[model samples]
Target: MCRNFVILLFFHICGCKELFDFRDKNKGSNCDVVFLSDSVKNGTITSPLYPSPYPARTICRYEFQGRGKERVQTIFQEFNLYHPRDDNRECDNQDTLIAFVQIEGRMEKIDTFCGSTLPRPVMSNGPRLKLEFHAVYGSRYSRGFKATFSFIQNFGIKVGVQLPDYPCAFVFNSNETRSGHFYSPNYPGFYPRDTECYYFFHGNQGEKIHLHFNYFDVEGVFPCEAKSASDYVEFSNFVSQDRKYERHCGQLGEFDIESDRRFFRVTFKSNDRLDGTGFNATYQFLDKVESFTTRSELTNETAVLKDIDGFITILFFLMIKLIR
Candidate 1:
């Protein structure tokens, strides 16, 4: 009976897929449904009459499914939707493209896109992602959107038993390995709002953590103040107010930082407003002695050892001659 119920549910979802067609009405059928998964790794989705003004009262749904430890990544090639005309315009109540991700069995809105401007890439927090295109009834319509979707493996490890309070918290330990890399949540994509992610790095005794950012493009201005309400990334040995470095935001070139202590912490905070393509960094666990040692000092020590060895040899030969 249980197996029969599961089968019924599977077909029920398949039947629902027929309700939304990605092609224009004249195309006759929903012949192509891009359901991304492990085997069917990647595909594309487009609005009905994409590149052309979509018909009024149109709705479409695209589903992405990934296997364990995999997440969906979507990048739009073109986007031109009916966006709000307010001074502080946004995607609200217009022809909008929205993405929702499933987390712990519940669906949550991750992002909403409109306007002619192309959007930053997006990645899901879990294995399932759904994209909905809604075009409201109106006399005027805009060219819709087209995007490519793929299932990518998630590299971040959550810090918790079963499910953590903060799903984005992760730990990098020297005992696990000497070096590794990590990225902002949905990195190379616009991160979500109201999110605070923490990355903890712990080095073995006599070691320290060194970090270098490869790419950084978070939203905000210079001297990103924590109290000023902007998205920023910060690095420190402590999690409190006595931080070792300033908050980083906006765009940055490649840079390097080393932790003063064995434990290094990185925090990324985003507000409810703007977001941009986040960052990716590489980290290494360096021994304190190796990190502080200089090449010139090592060369001088080698010269001193050679001189001592020559003096000892001469003294031994003279003592042998006197004995003879």
Candidate 2:
């Protein structure tokens, strides 16, 4: 009889499919802001070569689902600011303020929303800035689904002095040399031979500027060659005889830097030789960066060990049999 009752309850719940459906809909539409940074606090802004000297107070907020059965897990992340020195700085306009966010554990659904654009204007008399992201869901039985989002923000300003400009060049050498070639299937073509990319920002002489580098990889290749902490790097600034300040260098992997100059260059050199065969090295941008935090709560409802009516009925039958 107890088994029969349990079966009945299960069917009853299955029949009321709208119950879970309605619950899911309600939960999806709801947004719970889980974290808020104080209007004023000190934090560091990190980049490739330069680290911002002064800490600036930046505000952040996040929203998540709050409902029944289907638990909602929301994560909050903050990134160091990419503060450009001045309004006319070319580097400021070119560099992207990219950040990453991740969610871990069983997630029935997920979403992320971003504001229309970066340097999202600060509200008058308000210290906090707002950003939005949409939700993305994970597959069933996939308890932990991690996701990351990255974007660029431009701060219209050049905060430092303009340095002398330098001429930048890129030379590609393979077992074969072809003009106007985009990609190569050979060894030297695959691996970076030197750093030769550069960016220039407008500023005065002797002024200081900060550069930050955040690296990531998507191919799951560990110890891959690119712009990262392991590599030995250097930066310089100068003005050109043409009166235009420029930054220049050899071939370097994917990276971003902030400096005061009109001309810039990056040089790239491979650390080890690649096999002459196979497509081993492919030029690509680093993966997005991300971080996360989680919280969980249990409901007040308690589970019943057994049906009270069924227990009593069984006990009565057993007592009668014993008397007989």
Candidate 3:
């Protein structure tokens, strides 16, 4: 009995030690960073030594991954970083706080901030958000920052698009194969500054995604300022970062896009200024590949084409003859 008790206690100690090992991986000497894979509706993020000057040579990244069509939003409860100059990443400047999205399976920075000026509430675009904090060795570190964030469910409302949920990139899986509509975060409302939103659409088997743009208005000129340039909308058949099939900006009338594959994506980004009413759009499943027309209808169309071709040929010959 005594021997059995010793073995049991040993096993328990081993188990506890393993648990601590896992936690230590998530711990830094003076940084707190995490990759939240689960759905987190509410939480707080703060520097490791918050309320005091953070340690020099520190780096942290917090990535929040939304569940399904959900997006994340964050409000800065407190922010104070050392920004001696306006430039944040000049090396030997000041501490820097940055926001990024997973593009092409890599972290692509979308915005950066420094200084005592607190940033406006920012949201992610798509299901994934990557936040970075670098306490470079520089002047005395300022008081670290504190923030609270939450997840928002986007069920595709039509009335108006809002931006609180720029915690973005709506992703649809095989389970959500039915027809649907996707509006901007707040359709009729003014979007927030430095906002990014992503929408991942996966079509059902044997079908492609069809989209109709009821309204599209954003800042900047067309083509040049659209897409990844400034405040614009982008569409991609594949879900890689910065890989765009078509990018759109400016006020648009009725327009439609048909996907060639079962996977597609759309993203909307707003800079710090000049936001508009945003966009309202709808999506449906289409099967152009497997579709067929009646035989008689096909024959009729072919005959019409032949007749037009013959008439055009004759007209061309007559004009040539007249010239001769």
The best candidate in terms of lDDT: 1
What is the TM-score (0 to 1) of candidate 2? 0.18
Question: What tens-digit string does per-residue lDDT give for candidate 3 at 188-297?
Answer: 44454456778777777777777787887776576636343568888877766544355677777768776777877787878754566678887776675754344566
For residues 1-324, could you state the per-residue lDDT of candidate 1 as single tens digits? 332221111223322233343333432222224464635777667876666667766667777777776677887888887766744356666777788877557787877877777887877766777888777742245777888877755323322112244546777888887887888876667775556778888888888988888899888886886566678998888756445588889899887878887888888888765677788888889988766433565799899999999999999999999999
**For model 1, how many clashes?**
0
Give RMSD (Å) of candidate 3 vs. truth.
Answer: 16.5
Give residue 224's error in model 1 in angstroms: 1.9
Clashing pairs in 1: none
> Using Cα atoms with residue i matched to residue i, what is each candidate's TM-score against the true structure?
0.55, 0.18, 0.45
**Lowest-sum lDDT 10-residue window in model 1:** 3-12
Candidate closest to the true structure, highest TM-score = 1
Q: Which ranges in model 2 have alpha carbons more than 4 Å from their true place?
A: 1-29, 39-133, 136-138, 142-245, 248-324
**Two-way lDDT contest, 1 vs 3, winner:** 1
lDDT of 1: 0.71
RMSD of each: 12.8, 32.9, 16.5
Candidates 1 and 3 compared by TM-score, better number: 1
Model 2 global lDDT (CA atoms, 0 to 1) = 0.24
Could you give candidate 2's per-residue lDDT for residues 1-324 as a string of tens digits?
332221111112211111111122112221212222222122222221122211112122232222221111112233223323335333333223322222232221112222212231111001122223222221122121122211111111121222234222232222122111111111221222111222333223333233333231122122333543222223454522232322222333444343343222222222221211111121111112211111211121212234666788899999999999
Q: Considering TM-score, which of the candidate structures 2 and 3 is the better prediction for this target?
A: 3
